[model samples]
Structure formats: structure tokens, C-alpha cells
Target: MRVRDVRAYPHRVTAQLFSLEALGWDDSWRELASAYDGCGDPGRIVRVDRGLFGVATREGLVRASLGGAVLDALAKDAGAAPCTGDWCVVREWCDGPVTVEAVLPRRTAVTRAEAGGTSRGQVLAANIDVAAVVVALHPEPRLARVERLLAIAWASGARPMVVLTKADLVMDADLIAEDVRVVAPGVEVICCSTVSRRGIERLGAMSGEGRTIGLLGASGHGKSSLVNALAGAEVLAVERIRADGKGRHTSVRRELVLTPGGGSVIDTPGLRGVGLQQAETGLSSAFPDIVALAQQCHFADCGHEDEPRCAVLEAVGEGRLAVRRLDSWRALRREAASMGTRSAARRRRALGKRPRRLATRQRETRRGVGR
Candidate 1:
């Protein structure tokens, strides 16, 4: 769909109308959503407001509230809430209310530890094919932040790519990109500048034919601008970076935008703090250099501390690896492990309450019999 076509429409929902197939609907989704056939139409979540959702379906886009069942599921699991990029069943009542009945299982989900010191995790985006970790070149790139985002992206079960934005602001963009490539082994790193329109085509190509690309990064990184450039129109709002190089929070919500080539991009609010959640696999993927070295250690369970014949420590001592890199690995590893522990403890507590509940039920049954 072209931006011009959308602009001509009188209503936003009607302008964004697209078939389920164009929105990345497939046979697999059909099978998963089969149980909901009689309940409603299949749609993709385009935007999520406080408690309302903008869902795009074959009929068009509609504002829908959460169904009773969906709300109940979210109460137990915050991650279960419908988010941008989710495919779901949308039901409309005759009285003029629409509700999202259920969300189909996600094929890929970018998640991070819930903010504010909680064990519960939040799903940043769902059913994505590519996770683009965006980093700004101004004020120099934060390699540590890149590494962290990569771990979260890798854990999302989607191919990860690095997008270096604001390339035009810095003259050493290529050098920075190469440095990033060194840390991101086996990942593609592209320098993009919305000003020069550099690398926009390459990034745009990532989305097409129902494929979804998700943008992940901190604020002031130009994610919204990138989405506008890719969509060939201003589909999202953009704000100028502050004098201190910090970005103003312009995109207050996460939204899925469709491009002219029939692909989708999910733009999320710039992340301030991204803690790891069950990202052991992502850590390994992000720090393959460390993982490869640990393989040759004397002990299979080498902690890479002061263990004898520790290849990892040797690499650090010999300057083959950055000590900071190793420290990053250890820190993220501990955080992820801590999350696992907390989750296990919560599960045990829940299980422990089950017996008490069952006993109460039995007592109630006995009283009924006595009556």
C-alpha cells in the first residue's frame, strides 16, 4: 500500500485496510487461529493503547478491547497481554463493541526483564522475523548497549541485525561500524542516515512479502525517523535530539506500520533500561567469542574465574579479548540466572498453595455431604 493511497482515505482504519495475507497471515497462523474461526475475524495488532488495541483485519482496522478470557490470562502473566505485532482473533458485537478474543502463539518474541525490579518479563514485540538493534553514532556508539540489545534480540528467536543510525553526524561511521562488527560476529551491521538516505534501501528490503522487522534501541536513536523513511511517508512522529544528545520521548506508543512493499515494521518506545530475562541462549549468541574460548578450558564446567587452563582467562590475559567484554558476559549471565531462580521460586510458591486450595475444596465437599 502506498502512502498516497492511505492519505486520500477519509478514515485511518479504512486507509490501512489490508488482507490478512498482506499483513503476514499464513497457513501456520490459520491453523493456530482455527479454533477462533466461529468467534471472529483474524487480524494483526497494529497499536496498543492503555487498554484498547488497534487491530487490522481483512475488513479493515478496528479499535478493540480485551475479551474477558484474554484479560484473565494477562492477570496471571503480564507477557500474555496483546502487543504490537501479534496476530489475534477480533470479535465485534452487534451493539458496536469490538474485542480481541485471543492472541495466537508467537513465532518470535523480543522480551526483556520487567522494569522496576520485577521477575515478570515483558514482550517487546512478537511474531517478528528480524530484530534490528539500532545504535546512534552521535556522542559515539555505546558498544555495551549494543551487546546487551543483541543478547535480547538473539533470545527472541529471530535473526538479529545491527543498524547504526546518524551516520552522517559522525565522520568515523565506517570505523565504528567495523568495531561493532567485531563484537557482533555473524551479524550484519549497516550504517544508516536518515539525512542522507544512506542504507535506507537495505533496511527497507528486510521488510516485504509479509515479513516483519522490529526496531529495538534506546531513545534519541532515530527509530521513528527510520520507520518514516522506510514507509516512504511520515507514518510516525519524530523529535529532534536534545543538546545533551538525549532523545525526547516522541513515540509514546509501540506501533506496527506497513510499507509500500507489503512488509511491516514495529516501532516501539525507546528503551531506557533493558534487563535480561531467560536470555542464556542470547548471551551465548551475543558473546560467541567467550563461549568458543571456554570450550577449550581444562574443566567442562569452567567458571572462567581463576580456573587452571582456562582458555577464557588466558584470552583476557593475552589481550586476545577485552576484559570489559568478559565482565559484560559475567554480569548478564548472573542476571539471567537470577531471573531463572526467581521464576522457579515463584512457581514453587504457586504450587505449594495448590494443596491448601485442594484441602479447602475437600472440606467444602464434606460439609455438603453432612448437610
Candidate 2:
């Protein structure tokens, strides 16, 4: 954390001396990297800015540009672009320019639908083990936002953990954490305060030794503070909450920082909207209590809305489940379903256009033959 500590063991603070194994590489990555044997070194994307990438390889950190193949993949699907926490192949040319040749397969990716009404999903961070959803306790926590973030975390194929930050600012932190546990169902919930250093060690342990944890939440949630606390230094800038209790966006980009214990943490900018895109399993995972109750419904397709002998509604009636929770589930379900419909329509439209495109290509081929 001190200047001497950073200077004494420079590799510990920087992206140097991190072997492939330390970066969570495995047999799968080894096999995948085999095809690119003569291409370049395998690296992990530590940051992505504009169209450039900061890749961490065995040699250390290097700024690189996207290669032609990677750019083409991005043109087809934005999600295919390299994101923080992604393992990629980096190549340096004799002309003094480094480029990302290809991105390896991702084990897990935190994704959400694009903000501007697009059915396509955007990859936030890839290859994360734990998705920490930070919720501030100062201005009253929003359970709805917690549920939405938990759903996204579940869909990412990572273990979701609810971190109640700013606990020092609130008196009833434990009580609020219990309530959040109810909504998160099977997810782990812990309350911590960077101001008082409460529960920081336990949260920090999740990123220990070859593990990767991603911080996902809105602004003013103390995510950057947590990263600084865990790293034992001011690795990132922090901002105070506005006078109106609104959050100020401090993290402008997604960056993967290597902590002291050979672990990594990916910090992302505040997400304004996390639109659900085909996250059915995630919704079920986020609301397991409701899913379990729905299993006993008399009708297999019961909508839980004014349906006869609906177990879900019955639970709500008997005070077994909260009405607002069910309403939140319904809203997320509808949003995911709506996005699914739109995504399917778009796929069908693309399929319909494919034949015409092929025909056009065939005509061009014949014209070239004639020429």
C-alpha cells in the first residue's frame, strides 16, 4: 500500500510476474491456445478503453489494439468484443504495435442487455468467480435493485453475493441485511463498511489466490472503496455522494486490478439499466422461494395471477410471501420474456434475409465466372 511496498516488489502491484496459472488458466485454455501456437502469447484483458485493450501477459502489461479478426467478430456481435477479465491471445508486430489476435473461451461472463432498448446483451466482465452486488445502506436500500442485480449475477454463471456497503452510516445494518437475504434467497449476504473496516477481511478473502471477483452495482455503492480497502492502497479514485443522496459515477471504465493475494477484482462503471435478456433460469435462481411455491400449483401453466388454487398466490395470501416480491418477480419475468420475443423476431428476420443474401452472392459468383 505504501510507495516503498510498491517499489520493493513492483511485480506485485503491477501486471508483471503473473503467470498463466495465476490468471486462472486451465487445461481448456491450454488446449484452446494450442491452435495459436505460432501466433502470440496468451494474456488476460485487464482493461478495455475505446477500441484499445490493456493486456496482461507473462511478460507484463502492454497496450494493444484489436486485430482484424477480433474487429470482425465485434462487428457481428458486440458481446464478442474483449472485456475485462477475458483471456485473450496478444501478438506484437515488428512495427511496434501490439494487437489482440483472439479471445479465448470464457468460463463465465456477466452480461446484461444493452441500455438503449436493444435486444442484444452486453458483456460486462468475463471469467469471474463471484459477482458481488454492492448496495449502500445510507439512503435506504432498494430491494428491487438488489433482485435485478442478483438475477444478472445468476445469469452470469457466477456465485452471487450481496455486499451491504456503507454499514457504518446505518444503525440497522443487520436487520436490512436479513431482509436482503430474504430477497436474494440462496445467495450470500454480508454487511460491511469501508469507513469502519467492518467485514472487509471476509469479503477480501473471496478474491484470494487465483480467484476473480467482479463488483457490480450502481454508483455510490462504495465499490471503489472496497477495492481500495482490499488492495491496501488507493488503486481507484473515490467520490462522495451528492447532496441529494444521488451517486456520483467514479469508475468510468471496467478495470481488472490484481490484489495482493494473487487474486483479481474487476470493477465496472455504474450500470444505469440492466435489461433482462433471456434470463429465465436466472430469474428462477434469484427467486427460488417463488419457484418452489409455483411447483405446487394445480395447473401446470398457472400464471399466479387470479388463478384457482395457485400455490404462489396462496402463499402470498397466507403471508408466506411478500406481495412486492412477487410483483418484482413478475416484472423481471415479463421483461425477460419481452426481450426473448424481440430477440427471436430478430433472429427470424436474419434467417429470412440469409437466403436472399446467398442468392445475391451466387449471382455475383456467376458474373465473376463470366468475366
Candidate 3:
């Protein structure tokens, strides 16, 4: 965007405005901001309160609402919605508060199924570079959850990293991280202790300048702690969990927290319903080994179950792949596929037409879901 457009409405500038770079402002954003031609300021959303948003810009932090133009875009695609970590144009707007004219193109986005089984995708964060899947070591890492999260991270078009947190509370942190690493084909697995500060620097180094990392995990996974450790301050609050080891939801919404250094980190509340969207490419990335092995199956469309010369089954038999990992991968694949089926059905319903194979394919989807 043009410098004048970014500085639009110069009277609105305030001390609360944070450095643009800290919020991931760069040349790419300048180009998008230029579209406004001195009508609005380029801003990154830090928090969304109620239906309004709190954006950080060269003019400082301003509370804004979505304009009609962007709202129309959201009607067509959920990805176009203004989400935390999104860089948007904050217009002086018409009669009300400063409005977000439009959301610039996002390089990466983290999306999950909208809760309530609506088949709608809910974007958690946008324009992130790295996705840090934090798993605490105290209760042991759940590979199934890791695999599930990895699928989302992979689908976001960001580099996925597995961080095993609270390492000081566990005896086999490294071993557990290794187990997680087995499922993380091209991902990095780091065992970290927010208390002991283990792997803190390495994780901090992952963020700086224009780079933005997204932290995602279940509640009590120490996502807040890791963010605090990385920022060297208590930016996000944390809560003590129950004696039974279950964690209470602390963060109520997704927020973008800028590190003291540079770059930004988007923290999302614990996800109880971590559903995968149309993430076929994500499944392949998360389970590259399994996808590669499946390529060698005797049949071109082998399901890897009771099929002759099933490379996947043979690998499991030879202990080349963990049965549990493979199971989790299959589960995610099935869940993703089933979700796609449902999504397609919903789209067809919206169009007021029924496909000939809809019911048959749905039955098959149900039968294959738990297999």
C-alpha cells in the first residue's frame, strides 16, 4: 500500500500504535494498502471483541468493524473473513467507527470446522508462517491429537513444528517427542519446558521480523506458557487446571500477540472440536510416509486392508511403520473424507439439487468412517 494510504487520516495516529514490522507489516502489505490510495491505513488485527475488531496500524490501535464490501465477500468464502492475524485496510469509513474495508490476501490460514457440525470452516489465524503444535509432556503426548492438529497445520500452508512442553515434569520427554516425530514426516519436534526454559531460545528464534507463528493445541497444553516464555513476559494469562488433570479454557478467543522482539504470534483458545476442512494436501503432508507407501500398493486404488501386495500393511507387518500412527492417519483421512462428503451435500442442498449418488456415497462414507 502507498505510504499516504497507510498514513490516511493522520489525526487518528496515537501512542498505542505499535511498530508495523512487529505486526508483520512488509512490502507485500504495502502493495495491498496501495489499493486504498490514501483512503485507509493498513492494519493487522490483534483481537476481535464481540463483532468488532481491534487492529494495530501505523496510526496505532483502532477499534473497527467490517464494512459491507468485505461482509459480502465473507458470504462467498469463509477464508475472506477478517480474522486475527489478518492484514486489512482500516477505512475512516462512512458514518460509524473505522471499518475494515477488505482483508488482504493471506499467505497461510489455519481453519477448523465450525463448532456445532455446520460444515462451515472457521479460520483461527491468517498469514502465519509456522504452526507450533504444543503438546504437554506431563500427561504424555496423545499422538492422535498430534496427528489431527498436524493435518490442520499442514493444510494452513505453514511449516508445522511439534513442541512437547512441560518437559521438566516428564521422564521421557525426548522419547515422547521422538514418538511424535515419527508421525511428523517433514515437521520438527522439540521438547520444551516453559518452567526450565528448555528449547525456549530455539522456539523464540523461529519468530522475528516478518515471520508469524501460530500456536494451537488443546487446553492445558501450555500454549500460553510457551507464548509467555517466548515473549519473556506474561502477555497471555494462564489458569491452574483441575486435580483430575483436565484443563479449563483460558483464552476465550483467538488473538495476535506481538513478541517484544519482532514478528507476531497468534494464540487460539483450546479446541475441543478440531475438525479438518478440505485438507487432502494436508493429509499427504502430515503422513508423507504413509502416502508414499500407499503408492506402491499392487492395486492402483488399494485401500491397504486385506489387499494383496498392500505396501502399507506390509510395512506395518515389518514394523517399518507404527500401527498406531497408521491408524491415526487413516482415521484423519476418513474423517476428512467424510467431512468433504457432508460439505458437498450441504452445497448441493444450497443449490436445491440432489446428486444421483449422494445417498449411496453417504452410506459408504458412514460405513468407511470408523473403519
Candidate 4:
């Protein structure tokens, strides 16, 4: 199957397919194309269910599994594991089973730290251009949560936008917008209502041709409803929130869908918790005001905790800066730093074990030679 044939699918469906740009196909894909000339099939992973994957190819959709070779690659670097929106090469067995051979590179990846206090990062979606952080107005919103998500999104090398969901439930949108502004200053915020179609057009316009946007938020935030409304079809399954106004994980996995206007949207299951790992750069970008203030502090290493002449503390005391915002920034920075240290230690330990294994391998090789 060829790329041209794959493009013949319906425009809406084809938009969800991986493109060479998204796959980082400048020179590496060319190399893979040459190497796998007649040995494998190329496709993009559209959905992942349990251990099985639904891939879109020139011939259509096919279920695929990771072959031994691919699994070995994944073991070497879990980051290389096949993820939704990844372009891969596969070999079709005589029995009609498809095995993933290789995963193409990604231009942009949206990642977050693994939940449950793990230091490892988990890739949510790959090759994304926009990371839309959705927040609902029904539950009165949580600005701290939005800030955390914005930090992760910014760190993922994707443009971050805040989508205020269930806007129809709020009588005073200005108050909600004001609350979000404190946490996500300088970021674009769009109030969208699936019931009223508010800001849907703007949401559609943000996704342009050849661009992929990722939708992220807690469950019951109306993410699936918004996607379905924007797609102009019920392509995704919708679920009702529980009595506590929480989501039921209607969208179980990450899958890309094309908007009726243009571009693509990657909808994912509601996240229970978002952890930060190696997100220092993202934090700095997300809290630029705090970073800027720190530069003017009396001491270079000021912790802003009862430190004399601390600009951040002084600003908070003077009511110029919200204390909650500062606290959130500090908490995230500490968490990210701690996770980074743990991750570094794990890498060092792994590297330390390699030499011992290599020495054992060499001893065995020498014994075999003597025999």
C-alpha cells in the first residue's frame, strides 16, 4: 500500500491518519521507507484497545500487535512504545495477523507524569499541535487543576488553550473567565457550550489544515460532546456524569477525529490525576509572572518563604499577586524537581547495571571460544 492510496479515504477519516510531518518523516522516514521497501506495511495507530491496536492503512483498518522485535525496542526505551497517533510499519503474517515492526518518529508529543507518584512520563497523544485544556463550569471549576494541566501542555511542545465547557450552565461567564485568568494568564480561553453551540465556531477555526489538537480534562467535562458537536456527527460515544457530577470515562482511549470545519481533534479519557515529571521548562512558561518576579528578588536563591526583601512574597502580601497562584507554582516546581531527581537516579542505576551484564556476556563468549 502507498501513501497516495491511503489519502483516497474520506476527507474526515483521512485527516485522522498520520501525515509525514507528524511522523517526523524528513530523513528518518525516508530511510525506513527504503529499508522496508517490500517487507512491511505502513499505517497509523488510530485506537488502542487492551493490547490490540486499530491501525489505518491504505487498504483500510486492521488490528495489529507489537511483534517481538518491536517489543524489544519498546523495552529498550518505553518512550518508543507504540501510542495512539503513532505511525508504524507492520508485517502481515500468512495467517493474517499484523505485527508492528517500527514506530516512526513524532514531531510533537503530549506527555504527563504517570499517576500514582511514579517518576516515569506517559505519552498521551503524539504529533499534536494544540493542547486544549477543558474545564467545566457546572462544578464551579478548579483553577489549580487548570494551571497544572496548562503547565503539562506547555511542556509538551504544543500550543495550550483553555476551553471552558458547559458554559450554558453559567449565568456569569465573566466571573468564570476571571477565575481562570488568575491561573492561566496570557493563555487563550474559549467558553464553549455543547448545548448552545457557544464558541464552537471558534474552536473549529483554531484547528487548521494539517494540524492536530488534543482535548484534555476531567470526565463529564463535555469533551466528547464537544467533539461530537464539532464533528457534526455522533462519532464518539457519550456518557452521563455520576450523581457527583463526575465523568464515567465515556471516551476510553485516545482517538483522533476530524472536525466538520477542518483539522483533527484527539479525544482522550478523563484523567483522574495529572502528575508533573521533568516539567521545569513548562512551569516557567506557565508561570511567567512568578519567574519574572523572582529575578528582582534581593537574593538569587530566595525561596520567597519569609526571606528578607523577597519580591514574590512582598507582591503576595501587597495583594498584587494571589497567594494561591504562587503556592500552586511552588508546589508544581517542587514536584517536578523531585520527580526529575528520581528519574535521573533510575537512569543511572540502569546504566550501572549494563556494564555488569556486558562483562558476563563477554565471559560467556570467551568460554564458548575455549570450548
**Stretches of candidate 3 above 4 Å error?**
1-14, 93-96, 241-244, 353-371
Winner on TM-score (2 vs 3): 2
- The TM-score obtained by model 3 is 0.88
Candidates sorted on lDDT, descending? 1, 2, 3, 4
Candidate 3's residue-wise lDDT over 45-114, tens digit each? 8887788888888757777888889999988886677889988888875553688887888888889988
Candidate 2 residue lDDT tens string, 1-371: 12233243323234445666766877888899888998898999988888778888876677888999999998997779899999999887876678899998888999889888879988999999999999898778999999999999999998999999999998999999988988998899999999899999998899888789999998878888998988889989898647776666788889988887778889989888888854997899999999899999999999999999999999999999999999999999999999999899989998989899999999999999999
Each candidate: how many clashes? 0, 0, 7, 0
lDDT of each: 0.89, 0.87, 0.84, 0.79
Model 4: clashing residue pairs? none
lDDT of 1 by residue, 1-371 (tens): 44334343323356445777767999999999998879998999999989889889876778889998899999988789999999999887876678899999999999988878677888888889999999998879878888999999999999999999999999999999998997898899999999999999999899988999999999879999999999999989898546765557788899999977789899989888898976888999999999999999999999999999999999999999999899888888988888888888988888989899999999999999999
The C-alpha stretches of model 2 lying farther than 4 A from their native spots are 1-15, 241-245, 354-371
- Candidate 1: residue 119 Cα off by (Å): 1.4
lDDT of 1 at 364: 100
